[model samples]
Target: MTIRLTVNRERWWNHVVGVADEVDGLIPVVKGNGYGFGRAGLAIAASKLSPLLAVGTVHEIVGLPDEVTPVVLTPTWRPPDTTEPVLTVGSNDHIAALRGWQGRVIVKLSSGMQRYGGNIDLVAAAQRAGLRTVGVAIHPPLAGTDDDHRQQIVDHLPDIDPSLDVWVSHLFPSTYESLPDSHRYKLRLGTYLWHGDREALHLEADVIDTREVRPGDRAGYHLTEVPGAGTLVMIGAGTANGVAPLSDGRSPFHHRRQRMALLESPHMHTSMGFVPAGDPCPRPGDWVDLQRPLIHTAVDELRWI
Candidate 1:
């Protein structure tokens, strides 16, 4: 069936705002399928709002439209001839590895976050070399506030140059907002753009069919039989759609129809059926919006619409 339903990019765009204005600026986070909104789409949309925000890495930067102003998380090595990203940093031999870069860059700070930032020594070296230390990002303590860690940062940076901007905390938008001023230093926001303080939005595929049956009748790749008279509705987006389950712990289908996952079972055929708007119950050849939450999971396997 024709999956013609719109993704409601506007709905997503309209909701792409901060919950509060107390913060200084907006930095939309773009990572992992742009949180399923698609990188290019969200980047283009976010550009309409703020030019500054954070992208996870160099790969994400390439997907961004030129209009996108970026603070790439930790820019990978680039030749000096490669110039575009406004800010990003490196550690170890990162500067030499960068070959040559003209845009602004930050020395990644290894605070409580043990990810790909910098240590105090790296920051010192960057400063001595006169590399632009636009900011230092503290990516950790994500689970909760760490007052001792905050003080530790204060104590640890005693010799740090004040010209280096402090970008202490950056997590989901809510966490960024929750951080006390001492911890906020400079909050980096990601999930907050699509999911501010509000609860997550859910999508569910619908079961289009149920049938009454008995012991012998067979269905699906395994020739499984219907235990009872129940209908099988088809609901699944295959390779064509970005429905492939992700390895990341975050499950996009948390609220989606459970059957969507079942359809992927190798033993069960996942084709579905549907009718277009104002049409009769869909027969084969009818168009449908499988992307629609409720309608996606209800059709029977092999029941192509």
Candidate 2:
């Protein structure tokens, strides 16, 4: 039993290189399951594009190739145990925490997202401490348009030193190119880089078991009644594999180009989905298409074709 991600290697690699060529200074983000390719794999792939890579935290810095320099995106109050990766400082407290460290740091500026980041003044404050201020980071909210994000970055330019590099996220390629070239800009991209060519990627899970059920038949852990006389297809993906119902509560499993109904909530390592009486159903050894997002899923195998 397995959940697998199949990739068209040629198309996927072409898209990766294409994005690298289009973006001026692309800092490939290799964090949080590496957008489904896994972090180690992304780090290796990112090495071919840029020397610098951005990760979600210091802990993700491990297992990276020596050629790639990692920068931690999350703000940390305590200094990282290793000074290898550059750290992000968003507040005075964060800056003060690493006052004596001689490593590089990126000062995060507050933006529309309001998730993490400090005022522009934090840049100078980090320099005042013993840390080497390498760049300034701006993570704009995803809710706004590219123009809005560009304006937000422009609005902070006067206060930030022009010499320091500007790292930004959530901007379209055209919008990023529209920014002033006088200042250096590095776009931290993850989703756009890896998932740009969705047609090159596919996800599927194996049918581990199946059972014939009648309408009103009690089944599953909670003894939920069967909705109709159909075949109960037990899928190999479940909560353990980040397989859950869609946000709207629809089943994430699909068969024969039709969405299957969930028999009940997903359990540890399997989910039960029902195929209607007259609909096409998958046998125990067959595979079913899964509709869950790759970033949120854990696949048993990754096959590159």
Candidate 3:
């Protein structure tokens, strides 16, 4: 009836627990559609390791279990409703605005990513502003080399106080092993923790309807041309579920590298794929394997088995 995300339970859980055991200080990040498992679900999953959960906003903390303490990653104007949320302040202005909040704070430093955080002066300003600075957060870029990432951390070490706890993202295993023994380093893991073993996860959407299409026939919202005679296979997934539209004339057909009919861009809750006249076409009710990540797509149900 809808897109379903199936997880190999044993494999997935083993990976999850393995990450928790392998990492010394693990702060599991459960944000952004919960990286496909949903935030609340991942929150429960991570509770076994640590009571701490990192979310994108204060709003995401509502449904989390009482045992978990949420750390809000982004700057927010709204106060947390419950769970004594830890606030992140990237700039002096942010720290100044959050002066009313008496809860623990983590000063985010500007790594090479440049998305958030401030210079060393802001960290000092945060402490001076009466904010109880408990930890320092650093989010590194994903594309950089090992040397580049290590240098990124080394560059920020002088700015960070050794007494404060350190949290990092996108850090390599080798980098974690080499950290100074003096500081308590907690790695903020999300995709790498949940989706690390890609084999453990599978995505599939049901084929709902099929129809014949002839060359030059009008179809879809914009009346996209049907290049040739084929069967149009409509699948249960669309933009509403975070399915992205085709880009740069790209389609699943290009990625699959097959000679079958082209797969068109998805609709709001449905997408059409052309199966050429000569090729075997999938009948309605069959499922189509999806290449998209669950984080980028919403589904009606999840099968954890």
Candidate 4:
């Protein structure tokens, strides 16, 4: 039983390089399962583009190569276990927590997202506390247009110290370019950087078992009667593998380019899908495409073709 992510190596690399060329000071975000490529793999990939990388938390700062410098995106109340990665401080309390510590820190300014950040004064507070202030981070909300995101960053620039580099998220290249060129700006990108070329990545799960079922025959965990006469195909991905029903209650499994129906909710390591009698039914050794967002799915194997 296997779940795989097959990459069109040439196209994927080309896209990565192109994005790097297009965006100046690109800091690839290698956090949260590395946007489906796993954190370690992405850290190495990020090193090729830029020396800096961003992780969600200090806990995710492990196993990275020496060439890559990690910047923690989330502000923490306690000191990080290591001093190599740059920390983010959003509040005076966050700054106070690092008192007497000699490490670099980024001041997170509050944006429309209102997720994590403090007033622009936190930058001076951090500097007063004798911490090495590296940059200012602005994470825009996803609810607005690119112009809205750009405006949010622009709103804070006059107050932020001109010497500090500004790290921003969720802005297009054109929007990024529109920012005042007097200050250095680094674009912290994840989804747009890795998954931009959707056609270059493919996700699939292997069919592990198959059984012909008749209508009204009991099946699945609840032992509910089979909905129709079809082939019950067991796939190798389940909740343990990050395979779950979509928010809309639609099945994520597909065979022969057609969506397959789930016999029941996914189990720990497998999901039972149904294919009507006239439809294309996969055999035990066949592979089926999964219509899941790569960010949310975990695969057992990665194949770069």
Candidate 5:
């Protein structure tokens, strides 16, 4: 069965170009289903708009065509053959290991993100190795830190390298835009383009089949029972297709919207759930929201047409 997804293609392309222009030269991130637009579609779009290509890892490099300079956010395990890369330095030791290697590279400095990057000392080592250091980098915290992350980096940046060719990182647009033009080097954007700039993107899946359930009938795993006399509509797509809707209380990303509960009947790999908002909500062969509206949901299945 096929679950149809509506593509806001014009809005997407316009956003990509708009976002890229917001910064000096955008590094279009084309990793992992191109953040929902499909890698090929994103790569082609990014190639046309961005000065450099942004990708999650080395594996994603295969799809990009020539003329696009690719930047791999992954630490330097191997430099891909497609394009010369500014290898991401995640640790001080990795910088040491990269010492004596002559190539274009970016030092990934870690902060509240606490994920990937090197530090000030790593910069000195790179200079010593004769590596053409084009950028100072930091992947910002997911919480979107209140100036702490960038401030910390800015405090240390002068001491690291005052002549950085590029200062690459991700940040909320407010933060990114506030960056003094002199200090801001490059912006790596993903969510803003493939997804929406704000809490506006929507994802929907097709309703497949609906069944009437008696008040006490058992359903799915653990012998869960149907609570009322209502219709259970089977969505065309399920968890196997990455349509499993979910939420947790710890963060605002989840608390703001509703997610479909999991269903186990048919012993499925993908997921489809009985809509809590049934009848008036969705009809079989009709499209229904599979993810929280306005909240950034991870990409599951995406096909751009």
Candidate 6:
């Protein structure tokens, strides 16, 4: 028994292709648990759209298909020996480390977001250091109106070399389209590209064991008392599988049977959920419906449908 992510292949593929077609220069960000589909899965999907695939670290570059060129979004701690990625340079230290480094680099400029980037002078420093410049990267916040942040990019535009392109992340479709033609923009997208439609995906956990319990019975790792008489179900997902408690005390219950049950804290590779005495009790090996953010899921546990 195991927890798995089930993706509606047909619908999800349609959306992936649609987004690629709409965004002329799309560089799909396939990093960090691969956005719930694993790095290889999204990398394969991104290859169908463009030759460029964006990754968060250099370690993730190995499994990707050879046809795709990896653009590492994070600064490299040490010079990687295997692949020459389109690197990200956000500071003078990043530029200094690239003294003898070869290959293209993107100068990360600061937007109002205030994370992972530096002033526009870093671009000139990188050029002075003799590193090949591909373009500039900007990660903008999506909260409220993005106009002020978009304006920030415009203000920094003069700092960038006219020949270089611009790569931006977390921009709304409207903001992406609103950029002036004077600048070439490539959208580095992850959630918006892969998990755009939540309806296209679902997750389920198989029931591994079940035990009948009465009210006041202790249950789970913490041995908390059961509120009422019901069946104690051992599910196949836990903290190891990236199942976490919701911040607002909400449950990711999608099935009608799950609605009548109380989900308890998950263990390493299993979880305990209590179904009320009147509700249908799941048998061993039965699949229980569940949902969680794709970003929190482990890659190997996914089973694409």
lDDT values, one for every candidate? 0.50, 0.90, 0.79, 0.90, 0.60, 0.80
TM-score of each: 0.64, 0.98, 0.93, 0.97, 0.80, 0.93
Candidate 5: stretches off by over 4 Å: 81-83, 96-102, 144-146, 181-184, 197-202, 249-272, 275-283, 292-305
lDDT of 6: 0.80
Question: For residues 1-305, could you state the per-residue lDDT of candidate 2 as single tens digits?
Answer: 68999999999999999999999899999998888888888799999999999999878888999998899999777776778889999889898889888799999999988887888888879889988999999999988788999999988888778899999999988899999867899999988999999999999999999999998898999999998898899999899989999999999888888899999999989999988898888998899999988889987899999
Q: What is the C-alpha RMSD of each candidate to the true structure, in Å?
A: 7.6, 1.1, 2.2, 1.2, 4.4, 2.0
C-alpha displacement of 162 in model 2, angstroms?
Answer: 0.6
- lDDT (Cα, tens digit) per residue for candidate 6, span 33-102: 8888878767887888899999988888888988999999999757677436788888889889887777
Clashing pairs in 6: none
Question: Per-residue lDDT for 1-305 in model 3, tens only?
Answer: 58788999999999989888888888888888988877778788888888788888877878888898889999876555442889898987788787767778898888888887888787788878887888888877998786677677777887677988888878766678687676678888888899999999988778899999888887887778887888888877777887654454444322133523445667688877787787767788887776676778787788988
| Model 1 regions lying over 4 Å from their true place | 1-15, 18-20, 63-68, 111-113, 127-130, 145-159, 169-185, 197-213, 216-229, 239-305
Candidate 5 backbone overlaps, count: 8
Clashes of each: 27, 0, 0, 0, 8, 0
- On residues 1-305, what C-alpha lDDT tens digit does candidate 1 reach at each position? 22222244445445664332445555667765565545666677677666675777766667576776677776576533345665556576776565344456777676665667666677666655556556666555655555544554565455456666566554444444554444325556556556452323333333334333345556655666544433343543433443333444222222123222222232132343222222233323333333323212222222201
Report residue 235 deviation for candidate 3 (angstroms). 1.0
Please list all clashing residue pairs in model 4, or write none if there are none.
none
Residue 119's C-alpha lDDT in candidate 6? 81
Report how far residue 121 has shifted in candidate 5, in Å.
1.0
Displacement of the residue 178 alpha carbon in candidate 4, Å:
1.2
TM-score of 4: 0.97
lDDT of candidate 4 over 115-214, digit per residue (tens): 7798888988999999999999999999989999999999998988779999999998878988997789999989999999999999999999999999
lDDT of 5 by residue, 85-203 (tens): 55677676666666666667787766766666656677766667776777777666656564765675566556555567545455655666676545546767777655754323456
Quote the positional error of residue 223 for candidate 4 in Å. 1.3
